[model samples]
Target: MSSASLKTIQSHSTRTTPMPRYTMLAVLPCLLFASVVPAQADEHTQPMLKRLAGVWEVEEGMNQGEEIPEKELEGTIMKIEKNMIVTYDREQREVYRALFTLDETKKPVHIDMTTEMKGMPPMKSFGIIKMEEGDEFEICYALPGADRPKEFKSPKGSKVMLFEAERED
Candidate 1:
């Protein structure tokens, strides 16, 4: 073969050859990470929340074409301290925990917490809850930043909880 022809053929073969196995191995992890994501939902659970001495409840929702029958989840809170709280429910599969601070009005300000369902968007909301007479409570600025604050009532009494929703505006 002519020297130039041989050089051209060599260049074509080099360009078409498979990459080294080590290079492929190094790229596999990156490919997996591109397709895989770590999921964090229940930042905490019901039994986890029961540490706070209070009341708790859960309301059920319905699916498409289904009716939401009246169902209540009875829960209780066992107070751990002035700044810490936990709640547990009747079924006890769920628990919630909260670390609290204070607002200017001295209202309880939630610093951050795990009183939310799994599969929700990662979030932290600051708000206060005040209890009134009867089975009533108020979430001021509660679920404020969140599009919807999931609600739950305390079984021991009425420490109504409104959790941040999994949504980004």
Candidate 2:
């Protein structure tokens, strides 16, 4: 073709049209939202969370090899909803709430719980959990700032606590 026509074609081919600012603004939020939504949805859909979600009554508990008194255990309840765990006392008063994460790939299912209490700094505890038959489960965890427990036991002066719970009907 003519040189002028060829140059015009080349220039047009090399040109890049800028996306409109308003379109980018709108698309950026959607992109951010899309990126976030899947992670949140995936967290809720985790198989472990599905199995753990429910109300549970604390059947037995031990701390530092000392058993918690039966009276203290009475009327205590735990509720796992999504990734949150809420515990209530004998009077049904909220005791503490924690956000938890599970690593099911680990042999004994690793758990990390972060609790925030009013007037206190956030505390993170590491633990291992075992799901048993007949809707019973056990958890053994170290206190905040301590190493994760290697087993489901709270030996004397171990700074670990173990709890056995049964799912409520």
What lDDT score is found at residue 13 in candidate 2?
72
TM-score of each: 0.33, 0.71
What are the lDDT scores of the predictions, listed in order?
A: 0.42, 0.88
25-107, model 2: which lDDT tens digit per residue? 98999999888775555432457778899999999999888999989899999999989999999899988889999999997
Encode model 1's per-residue lDDT on 1-169: one tens digit a residue.
Answer: 8989977877889758766779999999999987775454432332222223344333332222233344433233333455654545556554555555444344342234434445655445454544434333344233324422233332222223342111111
Question: Clash totals for all models, in order?
Answer: 32, 0
Query: Candidate 1 — worst ten consecutive residues by lDDT sum?
Result: 160-169
CA RMSD of all predictions? 17.4, 11.4
